[model samples]
Target: MRRGGRERSMGFFEHLDEMRGTLIKSAIVFAIFAALIGYFMKEFNEVLLWPLHYVQAEKPTLVLELGTTTVMEGFNVVIQMCFLGGFILAAPFILFFVGQFVAPALTDHELRMVLPLVFMAGLLFLIGASFSFFLLVPSTIRVSIEINELLGYTLRWTPGSYYSLLTWLVLGVGAAFEFPLLIVLLVYMGVITTAFLRKYRRHAIVVIFIIAAVVTPTPDPVTQTLFAAPLYILFELAVFAGARVEKKRNERLRAP
Candidate 1:
């Protein structure tokens, strides 16, 4: 069998071979990125510690220090930092390879739709990660410092714990920014419609606030609002885009 004269049907082993090749390429890309990050570990360390610096700049009186409690903690943090940085840097290449492997199965129309969504997903993730790094993380640290001061305790954090918090918050918010893509996919699949989204707009707002509160490290309403506001905008945009997609789908179905 053939698909649009672009892809030929493959046997079990052939599919496995293609998959293996894709994985191999992705691994190579990841490894190269990891090595590069490891080589520049000092710069990467500064980037990771930016939130701490940001907090310090805001409040000169606050004293915060990051230390390693265990003998291997620094080494472990370095390894974690390298891998995480490497994966982030290599993600686009890996996605491209995966797309290439799967493209044979998609027709031109599907490819067009999928490629744009993939690009948008990457863009949204970057935006979300930047927001967390530049704003949310610093605010969280400041809040934590204030709370500790209130309790008459000095602020000190382990490198492992700090990196864990940084990675978790950044990656989690980045992933959460893919929410609109999921919404669009559901709309395309006929699982939901623009009307449905609009009807549940109020409910969605409540859920969005809930997610923001949960995702944010502090109980500060400002931080939660900062997180939720963009999500709400994206939700609205999704509803609009879904309406357009729904219209196009209906027109296509009605054609000839």
Candidate 2:
């Protein structure tokens, strides 16, 4: 019993040590990417400003001139963008280190399942972010300008504020795309099955629309629809996928 307690304590401390090492490695990789991205400020700036260009191309009437509100806001934007760029560039390594720390405790089947799910989640997030960057942001910008114009207000945007909005829009939309994965995971874990999803589908969609309304940076119908539509579609897909997984799980259970 004493030996067992000592072994358990050692295992706990070992895991903590592993997590610490993984974090240190991730930090190192992130720092390297931060330096590289910071050095390429011009390119990064161009990419960051593409949504503005996208809006301008479609709307000649919109007025947009981003300014700094503070003495150091310019540098602050630079640092923030650089840090974001670094995280984006180093995402794979970061995921890897995180996975390494978690993988040891998982069973072989769970290990196999986790990696592909992680990859899919990451891929879906990037797709959602790109969708926001290229389409949603421009539409939001255009709609916001139109609404402000209707209210008799002139457009004056600060660089810091604009960039912050851009970041949130991308991240929020990216996160919005991740909900279906959660449903699928829950199905796999047998917490709830496809029937539950189907039964509550209407309520789920209403909640999704509410979430979309809240999450969309601009409260335009178009953006909200864009957010809600895919979410509903993904929920449908999740239902089908969940049904299939449930069938297989039952089959395996009955086989033995």
Candidate 3:
């Protein structure tokens, strides 16, 4: 084991014990959050159904309702809600616990770097999830409704399918928002440079649009642009940050 810039010998069994404790703590936190979400399942259901509500309000002529084909569907949806919501709510605490477990093994400089990146990752995820919930999901749903109506199809989504879509959009976009962090890490490790990012900027933009189109679930160019715009901005920001890291690296290389 290591702590405060000093190392202490520890046996394999001791490490296993520490890991078991961390896992137990993490599981406890997750269970608590899951129970809390289950207790407020009605409110949580309303939040998940907000996009449908908004669309109905906007297009008063259209009727939209979520259904369940099987008796167990409702129960499954509840479980899905509780698990996903619990994970989201407990994510920060879980990360903190993992950080605590690993902190003693990391040098001070490495710990400092990792801590900020973890925090930034959490913040970016929240931003992306909020953006998806408020903007992307609704826009995609609206466009989907419009397209289906154009094809003479009425909108009748099952609870399982609807919630599955919701989870995919929210979590997918949130994960995508971590792209900049990956880029920064690559730059730090000298795997890619800022110049390469700039050289391929246009290509990256095209790829971003493609990804946005695939992820947004609608063919509407406007919605796709909305999804891609922030991602493009993040890519640029990554390039800028990578440039700084490159400069610092170069300076260090020349120092001695």
**Candidate 3: misplaced stretches above 4 Å?**
1-7
lDDT of 1 by residue, 144-227 (tens): 888888998976789998888899889988988889999988998899999999999999999999999889878989889989
Candidate maximizing TM-score: 1
Clashes of each: 0, 0, 0
Reference-based lDDT, each prediction: 0.90, 0.84, 0.90
Point out the worst 10-residue segment of candidate 2 by lDDT: 1-10
Stretches off by above 4 angstroms in model 2 are 1-17
Judged by TM-score relative to the true structure, which candidate is superior, 2 or 3?
Answer: 3
Per-residue lDDT, model 1, residue 186, is 91
Pairs of residues clashing in candidate 2: none
> What does the lDDT read for residue 4 in candidate 2?
18
Q: Model 3, residue 165: what's the lDDT?
A: 82
TM-score per candidate, in order? 0.96, 0.90, 0.95
RMSD of each: 1.3, 3.6, 1.5
Which model is ahead, 1 or 3, in terms of TM-score?
Answer: 1
